[model samples]
Target: MKGTISHRDSFLAHIQQQLGKSSSKPASIRRPVWKHRVNWETNEGLSKEELVEQLKVQCQQIHTRVVETTPKEAPSTLRLLMKEYGEGPVMTSSDRRFAQYECHPMFQALQKEGISVTSWNADTSREENIRQAEQAKYAVVFSDYTLAESGTVVLSSHQGQGRALHFLPMMYIVCIEKSTIVPRMIHAASALHRLVEEGEQTKGAIHFISGPSNSADIEMNLVVGVHGPVRAVYVLIDDE
Candidate 1:
């Protein structure tokens, strides 16, 4: 046995004896309680609108653009953004919200106009999905939740949406419904916990993307999009 220790019980007993512990069993330790609960209280008194505002302010610091629009105007708003970002080939997650928000038709319309739009197909092979995502100029996805404090978008990945969709694209566009905005990460965690408590299986991957990937080298020169999208945009729809 490569990893098995000879006389494991005796080795443990020798260590325990050196530590002056009479009992062979390890003692249980109590978890510590911190005095400050600032994380849970930072945005406690904010209204929905105020949270959205906070998210917008935070987005500025992260170098991400935030656009506000109504559900009725969402399609047009997205179209304009796509045009601004240099119209397709675009890759989009197979999130049902696209149809629910009536933006699916716009994708079809863009395709008809010769702007390539690729939707993540659940039936396709993983390699095929990656290939499509790699060739795309932009990736569009509906965020599962938006955290106001850090300006992060939460993406829960399933069969329809994979991890590559968020990382491979040159530009990322996140469609956020106003009602999905929360004060902070704590609320998002609680919501996921409740889903588990209610017997719902959560997705395997949950990505918290604050903005386009950025990093600094030893020289301290900041670089954007080193590992992900070069540009990021959040289109907030007033769905409520």
Candidate 2:
């Protein structure tokens, strides 16, 4: 019996025929751009005491151009950034799937503040879980990575994890591990590609959020919360 030619295979073969033996041709070559790599780390794998010293050196370098700011100032700025999109406080949950991030210091602190902390763990009932999300002022999530250039938070959803947590909330507090901060999109894609190569299953949704939910739809009035989070706070956790 003869098998049918699939549409995908046919399309690929057609394209290959059209572009055959064209590897040597250069298409309007553009000049290459140059960029200097910043050796942001201080010492190469220093000892404990030396590591502390290296940290001080790196801090000094970062502080040179950056303005002096207080810890209180940062949280306040974060809150203000959230409010820009008409968001309020926050509600958080510990997703068992992301156990690595469930123990974040910010998560504990937020819970202590009595901000309706719940969990989607096996122990919690379905009814309770839905109630918590519906009543949440805002859902704060912990991200696996943050892109500094675009100031984006990367959140991945897993089994028993509702994609709603990233959306339903009026505001989101994304705690990003500092080690995962990368300079560019290519770097981020490379990291994800490596994960796939290692046989890890990537989820259907990987959210990269930058700033609060916004829209300039009606007369460019800049309305917030058209699709997702009205506010996003990037908590750079020192993962050292």
Candidate 3:
């Protein structure tokens, strides 16, 4: 009877101690929304037409072109675009998005046509690969998300994607996944915050590329690619 009473008392004390600790802990604070509305509806998804309109306005301000195409035709479209560039090496990161094209007939045709193409691989050193990319005419990269309001695309660089890959090549082709498009920069920020909160492995460098590199510093000549890509092509993947 005494042992039972002691055990019950100990359990009761433990419960009280836990309650006290919980009470001592600070309450979770709630943040009020500051601003949300943009040119389009924040709570709704953007159609391809809507996206194109918003993207064009933004891309124009920064001297970039918007290439809108469906997933089925994207590979072929890019291949045709590259053909227009004539004979020049193309560099790309080993992003999973472009990996599908590696085995596709469309990509194989490009290789058969003598299009010098290379992608960064795990076996090779990144510095060497980046140097190689610097010599290439075009660099194709995966864009994580695009901000409809500002016309800026968010590109997070991790192990596979390097910071050098963003700037080295003369022409940059940003492949954006359609579903990841956000209405505004705040939405992208919120997504990043959520990623951190959820303990996701985040990128070391997050680049918000507005457009091709521009400089008015030297005699206002307005030189492009003085610092980065001379031209940027944002390829929107609607279906893929």
lDDT of each: 0.91, 0.55, 0.77
Over 1-240, each residue of candidate 3 has an lDDT whose tens digit, in order, gives: 454445876677688797875434347778865575553356348675686578778888888888878777778778767776555678787788776544246656757888767776657787788887888888888787888767798988777777888888888888877877877877787889899889998778788988888889988888877888888888888853
Say which prediction, candidate 2 or candidate 3, comes out ahead on TM-score: 3
**Clash number for model 1?**
0
CA-RMSD of model 1: 4.1
Worst 10 residues of 3 by lDDT: 35-44
Reference-based TM-score of each model:
0.85, 0.56, 0.77
Residue 42 error for model 2, in Å? 21
Candidate 2, residues 152-189, lDDT tens digits: the string is 55677764455666777666666555566665455577
Highest-lDDT candidate: 1
- What is the overall TM-score of model 1 with all chains considered together? 0.85
* Runs in model 2 lying further than 4 Å from the true structure: 1-115, 121-131
Candidate 3's TM-score reads 0.77
